[model samples]
Target: MSKKQEQVLCIDRKTLPASWVTQRTVLSMDFPTFAATCTKAKCSFVRRGIAEEDRQKKQIIPYILLQTADGGMTAAYNRQGNEKRLHDLWSIGIGGHINPEDSAIGTDSFESILKKGMQRELDEELARRVAGDPIEFIGIISEDITPVGSVHMGAVFLIRTQDPEGYLPGDELRSFTWHATQKLSQLNLELWSELSLELINSLNPTL
Candidate 1:
């Protein structure tokens, strides 16, 4: 199928209360309830093209942040990436639209299916064999001010890589650059990355 024709998942805006996705990048305490909303999301099926254009719907995406055991991250410049809005920008996360085929693992739960899709994205986007288990769900991100962010809600996840040198970029990403907190602000970050930087900076030894 074509990229635009791909069937993806989304939640109804009316069903997803405005309060659920705030200016805040992270969701805690009510995270379980927030995630449960995705599992209970109605009208989950929609074409990528239509979904991208529909602000009334929030495309549920798993934005996986690849980190080393020591908290270093694998980031890349995205000049040849799929999303044009993020062209020539830097990103710390690797993820894509969740499709119906994600359920091939025979899982009924949305979170399980979401994880499967996330792994598929990693396998497709990166050259190395990153560990699939023990991934952490950090938080959700939304940038209502931007057109691209207004339509989708990112379910942020963190997966660890053994070594930064072990991971390689796919077609969209040129090379994987290892970065620590001190070096992040030097690059032009995409919307999610900008938010991710803030989230990471705000952390104090947790998440």
Candidate 2:
């Protein structure tokens, strides 16, 4: 929504020197290793859509999947935003880009920057609904086959909330609600959300 470009961090594949090596194991890659190998910069502003293809730029997305202890998970319908293309689609992940503000948090490690960014995004999207909950770092999610997935990489997190009741809708969401594990499969979900749901189901079989 801000017309001013959001200076988000990105890894420009073209800028990496031949001496630097990047592994295919992105999911298992730690943030320190990612930042060390790739050419990082606050260059990829949002909505520069096809620029990613031209520049071979990969944007980082901190995707947070929230769940309560009692097999209840939170999901929302996508609404107006930079990702308005996904409007009406259901998603279990809450996240966005790592902006320049994130860097101000700490540069001690790339992991720390991502953590701060994820927390900021969660707060903005969820209105601090799960502020007191514990968030765990999960693996990454990457799919280069699709145009959207081609330019984006997901750094996934799982947040466990103490409240098992339910959640209220936030500004960015058309609606938010808690669903039982058995009912999750019935709803139509976004492509990335399907993967996220599978991951959650695998970790918590009861859910």
Best by TM-score: 1
47-105 in candidate 1: lDDT tens per residue?
Answer: 99999998888888888776677665555555457777877778887888989889875
Question: Any runs in candidate 2 off by more than 4 Å, and if so which?
Answer: 1-4, 13-55, 105-108, 164-167, 205-207
Going through the candidates in the order shown, the clash numbers are 0, 0
Query: Among all windows of ten consecutive residues in candidate 1, which has the lowest summed lDDT?
Result: 22-31
Any runs in candidate 1 off by more than 4 Å, and if so which? 23-25, 28-33, 72-74, 105-107, 205-207
- What is the Cα-based TM-score of model 2? 0.75
lDDT on C-alpha atoms for all candidate structures:
0.73, 0.64
Q: Per-residue lDDT of 170-191 in model 2, one digit per residue for the tens?
A: 6886667776656776777777
* Alpha-carbon RMSD, candidate 1: 2.7
Q: RMSD to native for every prediction?
A: 2.7, 4.6
Question: What's the residue-level lDDT of 13 in candidate 1?
Answer: 76
